[model samples]
Target: MSRLYVILDVFADKALAGNPLAVVLDASGLDAAAMQRIAREFNLSETVFLLPPEDEDRKARVRIFTPQRELPFAGHPTVGAAALLGLMEAMAGKGREATFEIEEAVGAIACRTVASGKRAGRATFDLPRLPQPSGAAPDAAAVAAALGLAPGDVGFEGHAPSRFDAGNAFCFVPLAGLDALARAAADPGRWRTAFGGDLGAFLYTRETADPALAFRARMLSPGIGEDPATGSAAAAFAGAVMTFDRPADGEHLLRIGQGYEMGRPSVIELGLVVRDGALSAASIGGAAVVVAEGTLFLP
Candidate 1:
């Protein structure tokens, strides 16, 4: 059988910049194993399978997959898939700023998209769940060892190590500077010591390469070496930031710069609504461009 698919660049401000995502449009008959295989074949950080929504009220059902396994939820895939869907609707004469719902492993996700008048569009989604502490984070030394950095190179602005999960769990490691962020590399031997298993390690620093950005970050995992822009991590980080920074009640925004090391510099916009020093809500937003559309031959 053949399946229709679209390739998109998520969180990108320009073509060829940002995380690449492959969205399978006609994914009704494909099994979970087949989806994983397709994701592997694409060799990107993630792929999305768009199926008919199980719930009539939802716009679509999306399943996200890494090369190795299917994720309950993912950032770029959601944003990319939502943008593609919105663009399709626009081409069909639908108006801009469409609000829709996507059913995922994490439950129902509310998404809003605005057509950019270009080949791309912008997407924002309210987090299905608020982030909370997942587990005790490894000490800075252990995390540094896992990331191939010195203990002294770890930590800045009093932001130590922490673990948080919004929809996905991530070990947040705060680095001292951009130099430390740039030098980070995964050491398989120390990976277990840091995260207790092969888990997503989010390395970030306040010293951003771009003056306009609030932070510089990189996501390192087992199958996906390093993610250019990571939305899920940013979502969870918002929770951690709210916990640590405890910003005054109201809306706070953060512009994250990522993927520069891989040459696919990307931007992720995070919005947080805090009330009485607690995070009441959070949103993730970014731009996605439909880079290619084709058919996928599958067994």
Candidate 2:
């Protein structure tokens, strides 16, 4: 059994700034139960398991898990997995840079590797651009009650609460100020009851702190207990906002800064194009760095 495990910092240009994830290579021998146990042992936001790719064009077969459950796709896990693969290839005497794809639960994705003394893999996946968004201005009363804010305090001229997805789901809510967002606390019961499952919530607070960045978002899943950063939700959010807002002309490239409150302080860059009142494409890519490499031994 291969005992190599790699940890990566995703969405941050430098190590230690972004979300840290564990990637276990050669996980073919581990069962589903063992995978969950391994994820729990890591106790990070998420952990990725990589097996030999089913297709030659693909790089690896990826399975992502939180301590609670397995996920079809996730952001940091995707980046983390690719970084691990690139490092593995280099150590095996491969060349400097490479391009590969990972066959994940979401499907095959393109991953490009660049060499900067160390292997850093950057992967971009085509998230199913939902033609129509699931959005309706939630009754102001219910929305305000849920957020513990007055009806007038919550709003957006171009957007409303919506559910968007690449591989995971995001219930997007926009708020007035970071203070309002910081004060917003969710009861665990409300999550399963309102969301129908323990899934993703993309909550954004308009930031006066930095006008250039646009906003700060806090993604929460009571199911996982805590997540420093979330990549899947970030993509879903960029897609949702673009789909719902059909403008005459122009593009919205949103910079989402999250994890500050948690002290990790991740910065995510996302863009979506809208034209003739329709959504076109969603692009989310970020930098990653490998922080540590070690072994996890199981008997």
Candidate 3:
């Protein structure tokens, strides 16, 4: 059997700068094991399989997978799939902007997309669930050892190691500066001790390469040593920002730059709606470009 798939650079500032994602449109008959195999075959950070929505009112049901396992919800896949669907409609003489719901393992996700060009688009989605502390995070010294950094280099401005989960869980590590962020590399043997999972650590710093951006970050897991961009982490990071920044009640926007250390610079826009010193809503938005399309054949 042959299935249609689209490859996209999601959350990119340009053509190839962001995280790459593969969207399989003809996933009617694929099973869980098959999807995992396909994700491994693509070898990208994640692959999205678009199936008929369980609810007719929704647009689609998207299944997200890493080479390792399935995810209930993911940031880049949601953005990329939404943008691609909207762009496809526009290319077929339909409208430019669309609002739809996507059903995932996590829940129904609300997404909006605007076509930017023939092959480019932008997407934003409401947070299905607000981030909350997952559990106790390891101490600064333990986190520092996992990242091969000194304990003093592990934290900044009272921002220490913390764990949170929006859809997926991640340990957020704040470094002292961009230099410390750049110097971070997961010590394979010690990583599991610190984060306790494959999707382990999200390291960030207040310092950024782009002066206009709010922060710089890097995501490191066990199998995937470093991720170019991590939307799920960013979604969960809302908790961190809200906890520390204590912004005045209103809508606020933040830009996070990532993947520079690996040469794939990507930008992620995060929006927070705070009211009464509490978070009312959060959003993640970014640009995506359709890079390639092809058919997948299986025996």
Once fitted onto the true fold, the runs of candidate 2 whose alpha carbons sit more than 4 angstroms away are 87-97, 117-123, 128-138, 189-198, 247-252, 273-277
Q: Which residue pairs show collisions in model 2?
A: 259-265
The whole-model lDDT of each prediction reads 0.89, 0.70, 0.90
lDDT of 3 by residue, 1-299 (tens): 99999999998947788999999997998999999999999989899999999899998999999998998999999999999988987898889999889899999989999998998999999999999998887688988998889989987787888889998888899999998988888888887777766556888899885788999999987667888888889999998888777888999999999889988988899999999999999999999999999999998
lDDT agreement of model 3 with the native: 0.90
Cα TM-score of candidate 2? 0.85
Q: Which 10-residue window in model 3 sums to the lowest lDDT?
A: 191-200
lDDT, candidate 1, equals 0.89
Per-residue lDDT tens digits for candidate 1, residues 244-284, read 67789899889999899999999999999998778899999
Per-model TM-score versus the true fold: 0.96, 0.85, 0.96
Tell me how far candidate 3 lies from the true structure as C-alpha RMSD in angstroms.
1.3
- Per-residue accuracy of model 2 over 137-210 as CA lDDT, tens digit each: 34544555555566665666655566766777667777777877776666675555555555556778666487
Clashing pairs in 1: none
